[model samples]
Target: MKLLARLRRAFGASRAAPDGPAPAQDLRLRRAAIPVMAQGTNAWPALHALPIEMLPVVDRPLIHYAVTEALSAGIEELVFIVDRGKRALDEQLDLEVDMLPRGVRAHFVRHNAAQGVGQALLAARHLLDDEACAVLLPGQVTEARPTVLAQLVAQFQRTPGSIFAVEPATPQMTMGSEGLLETAAGDLRLASIRRVATSLDHRPPADARLWSPVGRCILTRAVFDNLEQMADAQSPHTGDLRDVIEAVLRTEPAFSYRYSGRCFDCASPLRWLEANLVQALEHPQLAGEFQHLLRQTAQFVPVNEDLSQAQARALPTGAAAVTGRPRLRLVRS
Candidate 1:
């Protein structure tokens, strides 16, 4: 448990909130939007040539989890909002499309180099028309039996406007997270939110409480309308998706579900590495090996001991059999 706790924090694992109420009716959202503009990726050299979404978790790409979570939540159509400079995203989509299930549809559309996520979504408004849909961001991945989006979709039959996956902003995580001011709903894990303060906000509310908006959110036509209106105004400060959602919250009833699942945000290279390490601990084939590696403590090899024995005891399973890497040598110290 201590090892897991350490790794979870290392990877930015989200805190669980109370579970939302059950589905009032059968709500199967058919469409989902995956925005891949890859904003602010230049800071990390790994993303300079490779698409961030295509970055691998354990045995699968970041996009793989997004697609699986959408599919598991009953989304039949997937729209990828791409940018002109993202040819790698297109090629990855080409490979991803063929791998999708027969009935699942994957299509990519370009935004006119939009300013933020809200604007990127407006570019594909025609495809979705006026229906409730799910949105998944690639850099954030969550593991739950009923995927995070599925949980939101199940509750959509009642709320039907917008629902966001949210987590408790514990004291340890309050410093850098985006803040939200929320009023609690009837359910312990559900809340009604009207304000969202993004990092771009220069003057955020003084009392704004932090509730990190996990990358997964459910959207409706009202959200699109708000985005369109905001776009038409041609405001220089076209805010991100959180702004559009906050607008929707003002008029319609939107919920923030404190999902019971664990989420990992791979927003940076260091965090991405942590995500891989944490996920591999639970991976079917890698868990035992990872645990074995974690349990090992540093020790010096005896001068006369067999080198193979030292390698087997100190290195991870596969690493012990590799070549060309440095080996431990005892100089009778």
Candidate 2:
């Protein structure tokens, strides 16, 4: 295991040129507008009370994961779609204002009422301006590679249509949800977004492609139009993006890209635990420090182990066990 770790480190240390072709002369396809949907009414107060700015999957905040994903995907501007009374979110943004990347502008849209996700997106329509495409992320932590967003962006650029980030849903995973998908001409179509309460009288086609939409999507400005049409067409549902996407899928040629990563629904305690574990394992830097701390905690006296007994003693104060156990708490006198 140690040898494998050393080999992995050696390979990671060797840098490679950036992916994709040289920058086009125009250097601009369509400026990406990212809108992070964060509704105050639905947010768990306890989760909200926890410093979301400091809430880490591994050591990075949940919001940071989404923002970083967008920025890495060449998104030019970010607009956070929040609801009124969400002062916590505002404070978080202020606290991390200095950490924002240079040249990337940030904006916020606060909906006056607890509207639907479509309404929240509609609230930020002014920010869209002439942006041909936009990326919308549900403000929650998910385990995905940085290239996940990049891949979606590339697909959008090539197709100039709405793209949804999805994962293949097996029978085990689709227990509580409908798994009906239709494919034609290499494009995946969402047939229905039904609940378990509804009877599945219409089963999916035998050769139907199976994909479950994660809460992230790359959409064209047409989404804004769709939202408006949806609002006028039906009553709002406290910012449910699923409804909006369903409406759009009926009218537009929505495509799906199968993302290869685990996703965490951090709104629940169970999912949050899963997120932390997955992130800790995937984060290279954190894993390295953790392994080193474990060796010290075990009193491994090797030539390469630089920490003295005194230093090792202090390391336990902050280190969690490798066996998925919580850190030992020391009550102060």
Candidate 3:
């Protein structure tokens, strides 16, 4: 609720920004920012740092998906915004990033006393340079041919603007998520993004139209000015990407591009598990075994028991489940 109030206060400021976002020009996105810092106030203390950055979506940590998506979009530089206490993410990246292309480079920016997504992006302002930068939240992993980032970049290239890669979603999905966009009809791919919801949105999805962003967007350097200008209007700590987007919309006309991909957001706990299971089921080598395990686990699961508890019971007592273990064979009838 506090977040919603802050978002309202941010937009309610009587004074409007003096300028629009980086003149929606033909700005090339040469870098991508993957802020590993927190978003909103939802804390998952159990999973230190963010679950998406540390935990695995498959054979690699979840951050890999976002990075690969950025690379697929032709981004040569990747900047990781990290908080002081979250060195584990850096160490994990260190161990895994050795396989990246030699031409590609990785850099880190410390998000000092980060409060919200606004501050996280602000910390990386210097590295953003004068051109546009793709902000790829590791949580929003998309399984697509050109990739979610690439799709947004393509739109940005054709019609330069702060590209918000949006997707069709239900009211519940928009709740506690990023601000909802109210767009005016335009081309099939791009629409005039007019406003950002000041409060939690509960709107119905429509005809594959863009209702909300999928945690992937190409933000211009001018957004940094928008963020700074907004600081005086509201509590800087409460300001987030939504507030900055609203600021952008106020002075200039931004566009929302309906991405050609399915984004799996791990920002929500339920979605995190869903992304993992769904992606794992899609893995060629592990699919058959995982499906077999699902079949076995489903048949004997207790109706009233907790699912986690049921899974625990399904495993062999005092040992792991052994494949092809000898069992009693029924004789005759």
Q: How close is each model in CA RMSD to the real structure?
A: 14.7, 14.9, 13.7
Tens digits of per-residue lDDT, candidate 1, 1-333, equal 999899998998655545855545445689999887665467478777676687889888888788888888888999988878776667777888888888998778887544767777878888875677888988788877787888888777766668888887565544454445354434467777756654333443444444667788888778777767766877443423566565576468777778888788775666777788878987998899777655542244545656656655566566636355456643321
Q: How accurate is candidate 3 locally (lDDT)?
A: 0.70
Stretches of candidate 1 off by over 4 Å are 1-26, 40-43, 112-114, 170-181, 185-187, 198-209, 236-240, 297-333
Q: Weakest 10 consecutive residues, lDDT, candidate 1?
A: 199-208
Q: Please give the CA lDDT of all the candidate structures.
A: 0.72, 0.59, 0.70
On lDDT, the leading prediction is 1
Candidate 2: tens digits of C-alpha lDDT, residues 224-315: 77678778877554433455566556666777677656677676566777888767766777877665555555554445644443334445
Model 3: clashing residue pairs? none
lDDT (Cα, 0-100) at 149 in candidate 2: 68
By TM-score, is 1 or 3 better?
A: 1
Determine which window of 10 residues in candidate 2 has minimal summed lDDT: 190-199
The per-prediction tally of clashing pairs is: 0, 2, 0
Model 2 compared with the native: what TM-score? Answer: 0.67
